[model samples]
Structure formats: C-alpha cells, structure tokens
Target: MIKNFKWLLLVSLSFVACNNDDNTTVVEEPVSSGTASFTKYVALGDSFAAGYSDGALFKKGQEGSYVNIVAQQFATAGGGDFKIPFTSDNFGGLLLGGNVIAGVRLYFNGAGPAPVSGTPTTEVSTKITGPFNNLGIPGAKSYHLVAPGYGNVAGVASGKANPYFARFATSSGTTVLADALVQAPTFFSLWIGGNDVLGYATSGGVGVNQTGNLDPATYGGNDITDPNVFASVYSSLVTNLTANGAKGVVANLPYVNTLPYFTTVPYNPVPLTAEVAAQLNAGYAAYNGGLQYAAANGLITAAEATKRTVKFVAGSNAVVVVDSYLTNLAAYGIPSYRQATAEDLPVLTSRTFIGTLVNGNPAAVNGVSVPLADQWILTKDEIAEVKVATDAYNVTIKAIADAKGLAFVDTKVIMTQLSSGGIVSNSFTLTSAYVTGGAFSLDGIHPSPRGYALIANAFTAAINAKYSSTLKPVDLSQYSILYPAIIQ
Candidate 1:
C-alpha cells in the first residue's frame, strides 16, 4: 500500500509541473528609462495607441495593441500587470463594419446590410481593475485629449464622453484613458493627431455649406484645418502629457494621401454611356472653352481650376466630358473659390469610393474595366498643402518630446518608403494587396497586424536610444500581418 501511494503521488506532481510549464510565457521587456531604468510603464495616445482596427475591437487586436504587447514584454521582465481592454472573439473591432476600409473584410453570414461592427462590452469600470496601462482613444485629437468626461461611458469619468472614441468607451464610469493618466504614469507612448487630418480627407474633403442647397456634396465647402491652429493645439496637448512626470514616446503623423485608399482611386468623373457621352461632350467643351477664355482675361486664375479632359473608358466606345464645370464655372460668385464642383466631375470621382461590379471581377470600376487603382496621384497643390502642414506638426512634436524627455518615433520618415512592393523584414514581405503579409489595412490609413508590429519595433528602438534602456525587441515571426483575399 505504501508503494502504490508513492506512485500516485509521483504522477500528481508530474501533472502539476506540466500545467505550470504550459502557463509560463516569459518575455523580456523593453527598457523605458535612460539606458534602462523604468520597471513600470503607462501608455497613452489616440486610436493607434489603442488596438482599434477593422471597424471593430476584437479580443486579439485590443490585447495585441502595441501598448499592450510592449507591456507584456515588460511583464515578462518582471514588470507589473499590463491591463488592456478585451472583447470576446466574433465581436467586431469598431462599431461600423470595415467596408470603407481599403483592405479589411469580414466573414459573411449570408445576410444583407451585414453586421456592422460593435464596440466591446467591457467598459472602464469593469476591465480596468488595478493601476492601468494603455489608454488610447480611437478618435482623440490633440485638443480633445483633455476634454473632461469626453469619452467615458455615459457616467464614469468626464474624459470618456467622446463621439469618436464612443465605440471603444464603456458606460461603467470615467474614461479608461483619463483615469489611467491621473495615476501618475512612469512611462507612456503617445501617437495622436492623425485623425485631425484623416477624418477630414476621408469625409470627401468637403465642408457643409450653411445654405442648405440642393445636395450636401454641392453645398459643402473646403473646411480643411488652418495650418496655424494645428500646431498650437498639438503643442498644448504634448506639453500637458509631459507635465505629469511621465516619460513618454511621441509619433508624428504619416502621409494621409499615401494609403492605397487615397492613391489607388480615380480622379476624373465617371464616363457616360456612348450616346450620352456625345451629347454631353458638345455642351461640356463649349462650356470649358468659355471658362478658359474668361479666366485668361483675369476673370479667374487658371491655377485654381483643373484642365478639362474627356475620358475614354475601356470596352466603352464613348467619350465623356463635364459640362458641370462649364455650366457653373461662371456661377463663381459662391463662397467656394472658383474650384470645380462635384457636379462638374463624372458621377463618381472620390478617390476612395468603391463600386461593385455585379458582373465582372469584384475589383472592377463602374462595372466595366479592371480600374487602375493608382489613378488619383496627389496634385502639386495638394502635395504642397500636406507637406507644409506635416512639417509644422513635426516641429511642434519634436519640441514637446524633447522638453518632456520622451522618445520621438519618426513615422513620417518611415512611411515614405511605402512604394510599389518590398520586403519589410526577412520573415514578412510586402504584397500589393490585402493578402496576408500586406503591410497596410483595408483603409490604407492603418497598418495590418504585421505592419503594426513593425511600428512596435520602431518605437522600441526609439525608446532604447532615448532612454538608454535595454528593452527586448519583439519577435514578430509568430504574427500574421497579411490578408488572404480569395477574389470571387
């Protein structure tokens, strides 16, 4: 009986050891202090800081956000708990589905108006139990960061009442982000302000006209931000972030136009039917001729207007021109500077607008040709506007980071290399489309899982250099950054 008891005891011990081994996942954390000193960290930023992607906040993504991932690395190195938002699988990432995205897609349940994405059920009061980490609001801007209770659940904290961050916020109490900041963080990572520009560009780059005219598109004017205000608010936000004794890392904005959504879109209006094209072409040319003559007479600067062009679509024996420009070119007395109206362009001209073939390959344009994705190259004026604004924002960011003693992650410089196709690393390479490994998400603005990992590495490197800390760089091998799109 003694011998038998010993045998059972030995088996029980072995089982416990096996379970322990499975649970043990040791990872080296990155250094946060100068040359390696910080043992604690708190991350704060906007959407990029949060793991909100694919129009939904899934469990994998929310936990996998760079902030949380880096926190995990820290925990493995004896850092403390790395608390982040979590949601069950099969739940969406953000509230709205990712159809507007340039690459993200969803599994079909074979239903129309398919499920729109949804925010997580775990609100602030619930998920955040202890001293928290990773407080990134999805739609936060430089100025909005301090809006009291702006993004919180209907009640918890004032910082939790944001419309943009609403999808990720909880109704439990105060905002998860604002409360985390009040804890007096030791280390943080901040990357905000992308939405300041992205939101404007994505919304068709038009502003609503108070006139309440025929169509919203026609009435809207250009409400792009004034360059000066952008810098001032950015500085204010950055300065405040540092005032709390938090050693943080700051990132600059990426080129808003570089994303495939912006680059791979059409510029000209749609082509008209063969017979219709001829009739419109006559009126359109006559109208354009008059504008050109009038403009030369000091009536308008030719620089202000797009040169008229008649498009020849593939498989269509027709030439379509815009009478819209000519028709209202002289109606220039409106609030909008004599720029051509949406009415003047083809029916659909938005760079990011998508149309289903309902006939040909899913990627077809206007139900006909395989639309060339790289149609709307940024015009010189647009490039000038982007660069000038970007430079101003970067200057402010660098200054604040230096003052606050945080690392500066130069995302602007990093993204300049996103051209054609190239390998980002040995294990993962870049594909042109949404195939798994493609660096960009469907929206083109955000990065794919692989791409975000790349961002994490860059940030780690920055922290290492600035703080003299010896944080471990992540092994991105296990992660899947590419999309696998099986075109039907």
Candidate 2:
C-alpha cells in the first residue's frame, strides 16, 4: 500500500511540472474596442446635397445642410471637427436670397415675369463657405466631378479657382472633393446626381425653346447621363474614399418631375376675362379675314404686313408664319384643342390670365369648352424613364456600399416622403408646394430649413446604427424658419 501511494504522488508531481512549463506565455488577444473610433468625416454632392434653397446663400439655409448638422453632432460625440466650405455670410451686401449668381430676377432684369408656366427661379448661389466640409457644388452633374476646370467654372477660388473647395483646400487649385479625400478623411457622406435629371425636368424636356412654353421639340431625344460614365466616376470616387480607410455612405437620386414646381402649374391654358376674350377673338377674326382677303386677291408677297412678333430690320422683310407655327396652331385647335395659339396666348405664362370674371361669371369665348394643358405633370413615358434611371442609380449605390461594407443614405425615398407631406416639424408641414409652404422654396426644387433638419437626422441615425455610437440627432424643433414667403 505504501509503495502504491508513493508511485501515485510521483505521477501527480510530474504532470503538474510539465503543464506549468508548456503554458508559460499568457498574452491576451486584441479586442474590437476601437470599433467606434472614426474621427474625421467628409461630404460630397451637388446643391440639394449642399442645402441650397430659396434665392440666396444664407446662414440658415447652409446650416440646414444635413452634412453640417451631422458633423456638429458628431463633434459633440467625439468626432473630430468637420468644417464645411460654405458661402452663407452676412456680407451686408443686401443681395436678394435667390439672385446671388445674377440670375432669376424681375422681368426688367432679363428673366421676364415669373412665367405662369412653372419654371425653377433659383440659379446657383455663391460659395459662402468652402473647401469646406460641405463639398456640394451647384449645377454639377455626375461626370462633372472629374471634369477638368470644374472648380474654375463653378466659382472663383484661390488655387485652381475653386473658392468653395479652396477655403478648406490644403493646396491651391485642387477640387473640393479631391482635396477633401486627400486630407484622409476617416468617414464620408456622399449624395450626388440629383441634378442630372432635375435640369431636364425644369427645362421642360430637351431641345425645347427658352420661350417658357411647352413644346415637344424640347425632348431632343437625348439621355443626358451615360450609364458607363456614371458607373466609372462613382466607382472611382468610392475607391479613392476607401483607399485611406474612409467609410462612406452614398444616397440615391429623386424623381425630378415629382417636385412642386412641376406639379402646381395648371394643366389648362389660362382663362380670359369677358372683355379680353372679346378683344382676342375680334383680333383673331380680323387677322383671319385679312388672310382670306389677301389670298383671294392674289395679293401675296406684297411686302407681307410685318408680323408683330418678328421685327423688320434694315429693310429686310420676310412674311412667313411658315409650317411650324401654322401646323402647331391647326393641330392644337383641331385634334388636341388644348394649347393656345401664339397670337392668342402671351409670350410667357402668367397668372394674370387666370382670367378676370365678367359680371362675376367665368367662361371661355362663346361659352366654348377648352381642354386643360398638361404641363407640370410628366408624361407617362417621361415618368417611366425617370423611374428606370433612378432605379439604376439606387442599385449602383447599394451594390457599392455592400461590396465595400459601407453605408448608404436613401435621400431619394426621404425626399419622396417629404414631397408627399410625410414630414412633421414644429413649425413646418412639408408638402410639395412652392415657397408658400415650408417644404420647398420659390425654386420648387430645393427644401426649406425644416426639410434640411429632417435630412440631418436621417444621416445621424444611420451613423449611430453603423458605428455603434450614440450620436444624438438635432431637434427639428430647433431649426428656424427659412423664407419670409411662408405664413406664420
């Protein structure tokens, strides 16, 4: 028994000694503790992405940019300071809000009266702040991002002349986006390509005249954005951003024709007052009779009476209603009976012809029925095209984000909800309305201050979710009013 116990004790001692020697090193594995450590962020996009609205580059509008608001919140939550290159300064220059770039002004100022036909009145504003955290360029298209001389064409600047990017640029003459990425941002938010289709919608189709009337010739049958070009620029941008560990979030484009500017224009021609109707019909009749008289008398080409619209200059006179105008009038009156003749209608659309009432009664000449002209609404074909393009863009955005394990900001859906009155702020109920409503400004394309805050909150939520960081959203209530056009 004693011999057995001794052998057992020896065996235990040997086992303990062997284990101690083999497990000498005790290094702990590294943890994912630094998971929420993104400090620097950059944002890139066009005007809507820039929070440009109303007629000017005001502090209120600029501060409303979702990117700026999110950056401020991030700073409080341990993010590095994210500065924007903006231009919303109180310069004391007394410039009107929408006319910063010398466009969209009174009739005498070259723009003529606000066309009764709904047209966007806002041109691009200046870079109030730039080379900034907000690298949103006005009037920029998708391909324009890498296009040379873009900075110079966009605005005046220090180095290569991109004042907007120059303000925040580390080098002279570098583009705002390129410069921002070169700075090695840890994170980025990109919302681009809205203007690609937006311009087409506002221009009322391509190849259309600037005469402020709806003409089919405008659809010059050209697709402005080349899919290949879009994919290349977008992929390159994403690649560059992630090259330096920049986690990115990209948003999709919205349907351009769905906005208020296009939605509110009356579908029918402007009505006329009884007196004006009589005068117009009388004039038309006289003109018709004269035409018949001239034709019957073989009095053709006798220095044809000068057309009121066309000027006879340097003794050069030509009488030609030609086929274009005549065909247009005949087709309109007979088959469509929708549009008004050039002689019958003013050069521009006007609310004045909303038509005064005669004896407090409203009706067309001879009480004849008139068809409504569909201007604001996109035709079925146009809508389908817009949908297809938007879908493709969204697909690209999602695929890129997923492939790179990044985030995506769906501003397109957000905007649609907004236009449909889905948003509810303290002082605003955003609808697809003009400046009268808080949803959009006189431009009918861009959002008001409240709308911008909503966007900021969206970005903030996405960031919080992805990084496991608890960044609080800005209170929509805190956002102030944007334009005086809105009623209290």
Number of the top candidate by TM-score?
A: 1
Root-mean-square deviation (CA) per prediction: 11.4, 15.1
Question: What tens-digit string does per-residue lDDT give for candidate 1 at 138-180?
Answer: 6555555555555444432222244334434433244445555
Per-model TM-score versus the true fold: 0.67, 0.62
Instruction: Quickly count the clashes in candidate 1.
Output: 47
lDDT of 1: 0.52
Model 1 TM-score on a 0 to 1 scale: 0.67
Model 2: how large is the Cα RMSD against the reference?
Answer: 15.1
Residue ranges of candidate 2 with Cα displaced over 4 Å: 1-38, 88-100, 103-131, 153-173, 207-223, 272-379, 425-429, 484-488
